[model samples]
Target: MSGAIIMLNAYFSPSDLAHVKICPSAKWSPKGEIVAGINGKGSEPDQFDTPYDIFIDEYNNMFVADSLNHRIQKWPPGSTKGATVGSMARPLVGIPYPTKIFVDSEESVYALDYGHDENNNSIVKWRRGLGNNGTLVINEGIAIGGLCGDMDGNLYISDYDKNEILKWSPGSTKGILMAGGKGRGKALIQFDGPRELYVDGTHNIYVNDEQNYRVQKWRPDHINAATVAGGIKCLNDFAVDMDGNVYTVDSCNSIVQKWSPHSSTPITVVNGDPSGIYAISFDTYGNMFLCEGNENRIRKYSIIYNDC
Candidate 1:
């Protein structure tokens, strides 16, 4: 259940459909040739059922949110099989359907459940080495689309129903409105279907305004958001590297673009691949991994650059 290592020869090139230009001094390439996945792509223990999100921990263990499977599978580095870390079959009160999974600095796992019980969308936390079941952290009645954590262990969730983002401090029961509590709009303070988000060390939030077709950057404690990148169709997810560069996946265009801070234009890193990518993430080594929903596989890409 491993993926193939694809070596892309041209870093950037001008084509009839998508124009890409590679810098003479710098280029992009793949790293070591270790690509792994489940046995085929299904609901079996060794398979994945429409994985929507993935998180790599400090020890290089990967946690995948098997959305349709209603479980989270933990795959150790270099291991072929994965163990179920969290699942709806666990002793939980309601039907816990996990949509997104986030691992904090302490290796604690948090999942955003769809709340099939009474429409009580909740965020559950599971400490490292603990059992499958998680403790309820936030049980507010809101439709959550994405979940991410800051460096200080604070959690941020995107409310698709409210068209806003909610923030929850560690050990807090209730969540406060961080942004977009207003109705959906194209304004600076509103969000129309805010799906995926990433919070940096400085507490600044980068959210994918899916329906608005733009990615927004909201500074700490700021109500107004500035558009970092836009004009793409159907932005699915985004990830921020250690250097503050933002990478976003466009479903409609079938490409992933890299946008430097405050830059209007984006450099095309991942070319147009028609697999229907649903999520994007970065590991500790700056390697990028994307979850292709249709292909039922996760593709890894390494970044190569220079000072110029």
Candidate 2:
């Protein structure tokens, strides 16, 4: 059962927007048909005020994290769709700066509030229709901006300022250090600042390891330290496919590279010059969804199987 890799067509609107910019983060729906992410428009002279973070939900609902506008918008899955859901609070629902969002099986929304004030930064979880209900509070000087969850219902947060990952269970305040804290020596490590995280079926924790320019894997049971995947460059967010092959968004390289535990070199599976990929993900069926930041769109790549 060998697997083949190939780059597919890019997805975006040419008539509506005309220009592609930067897409920060992207997520695939549980059903595998939709994708959502942040679309940053104009980096230089243009100065387009279109910084919309989109959410492609299971039902194909697109939610945009409009940062500068101070709101989250929604775009339903259809031909006649556009952004709908938004943070209408006087000052923007206290979700000042949202980095990422995760929706559970129950449709509950979990957003990472980088926070207006560094001291007030927190991870907010809101019920489907009930708006923002406080779940876990990090008021004690702990700022949570990135997040991921495990099979057993435990939540993992990337503490950028602290340069570590904190483990939080249901109704728990005290978090255990999963990786990169003060005691850990800051090398490729000891992340200069950690970003997003992904937990696999085997309980392996994959930290973005952002500033380190690679991804780090660690086991909950074995917390001695973290291991690098293959010394990637400018790794944004990485995801494990159905077969456990690791795929990372190499922004600097403008391509999505695939890695394996046995391989030293990563193979480019997708390419777009200066694409500026912010996130990468895989659906249950093995399809790859890339958040092309420079293109301001989410493109899908089918993993072609072949004898390797």
List the global CA lDDT of all models: 0.69, 0.53
Q: Please tell me which predicted candidate would have the highest TM-score against the true structure.
A: 1
Model 2 per-residue lDDT tens digits across residues 89-175:
544244666656655444455566665666446655545565543343344456565776654566677877778888766556677
- Tell me the alpha-carbon RMSD of every candidate: 9.8, 11.3
CA shift of 92, model 1, Å: 3.7
The backbone clash count of each candidate, in order, is 0, 11
What pairs collide in candidate 1? none
In candidate 1, clashing pairs total: 0
